[model samples]
Target: MAIDGFTTCLWFDGQAEEAAHHYLSIFKNSQLGHIVRYNEAGPGTPGAVMAVEFVLDGQKFMGLNGGPQFTFSEAVSFQVRCADQEEVDYYWDRLTDGGEEGQCGWLKDKYGVSWQVFPTELLKLVTDADPAKAKRVTEAMYPMHKIDLAALRKAHAGER
Candidate 1:
């Protein structure tokens, strides 16, 4: 059987629709899908959004206006694989607009959503067939706040 893209559900206190719009604006290939509101017999307030389905970069996601019972945590995050340093920098800056930055290319967006904006080349280098090169790449990565591809490449070559 063919498998579609994964769907991630985000729970918001009262801004499911708003958040969906925000996300769609950020991602080039995103758009709002469906808007479902509560009925008299439903769980949420009658006119409030019960859930909003959206697609970001071809990945489906459901945003639920599930009240303020829960919030997002660092444990759950989205990984954006970038082709180069410029792409990595663009996502890293945009995602961390009003949030904190973590080590190793990790960041939390304004909505408290965690994201990992990393270069695709870094993965290949870290998993290189040469054990010494991989070890050097691993060591170089440990001290980084945001990924530096040049530094990583230099590390793999054992250059100062």
Candidate 2:
């Protein structure tokens, strides 16, 4: 494939390859592309992974072994929009496995990558034209970990 256009590069301390494999295993349409290793370079030990090219559900990404100088923060996150509660549960469970769950459907993977696994219904409910319904949905979501679509729907309908 031609190396061009936009692609996200995820920086890791020394687990680029491992993270790539883990991501590929989690997403259905994911695959690993080129994996480059460090030679007798001064930056890293020989045979250590330098960078890995991968595709997660069709989005191209590069995992760079940039050492421990930097780490991932919750400020940057990939949002996965789900059509239903099942999709939300699937991504939430998979991404949060051996990881941490944040408020309002956000989570951090084992590799410290932040992600938002939420259903589309939640968005619709929260953005409703009715201020009361929208406020209820927002209030209900504030205390959620992985997001409860059913609860959001109920809140949108003004039900407790």
Candidate 3:
């Protein structure tokens, strides 16, 4: 069952169920919830999936087997704030598998969903009170696709 309240809806070209399962497999605390199918009323073939509701680590999202009319865009993205380098690497690798990677910790999942797999230390380093530390870290990050936490930490501490 979908928990009541705001739920993000992702439009897919017939891959809603597949994407839901993929996400469920990746996130430890997530689950694939209720699914709805198209009927003879016919936006899709009868008995085919029409939508799916899933929870990824407590975040609710609805996937619509909507068709080729709409597509995922980078204007909106899911940000995964990782606890450390391991978490960042885990998400970055999985999310970028068979998908394109973007600069600065962002990548498109195999299903075209944009995700930011970032280390929590990034926020701390980037927002540090020392302007030089923050700038160094920021500059170090802008050129990278998958975040390198060790490098960022070095830059933050004024080390090469």
* Every candidate's lDDT: 0.89, 0.92, 0.92
Worst 10 residues of 3 by lDDT: 1-10
Q: With candidate 2 superimposed using the best TM-score fit, by how many Å does residue 102's alpha carbon deviate from the native?
A: 0.5
Clashing pairs in 1: none
lDDT of 3 by residue, 67-107 (tens): 89888889999999999889998888888888999999989
Residues 53-100 of candidate 1 have per-residue lDDT tens digits of 999998899999888899999899999999999998888887887888
* Model 2, backbone clash pairs (residues 3+ apart or across chains), number: 0
Model 3 scores a C-alpha lDDT of: 0.92
- Candidate 3 collision pairs: none
Reference-based TM-score of each model:
0.89, 0.95, 0.96
Q: Considering summed lDDT, which 10 consecutive residues are worst modelled in model 1?
A: 90-99
lDDT of 2 at 156: 89
Worst 10-residue lDDT window for candidate 2 reads 40-49
| Best of the two (1, 3) by TM-score | 3
Ranking by TM-score: 3, 2, 1
lDDT, model 1: 0.89
Model 3 misplaced stretches (Cα beyond 4 Å): 1-3
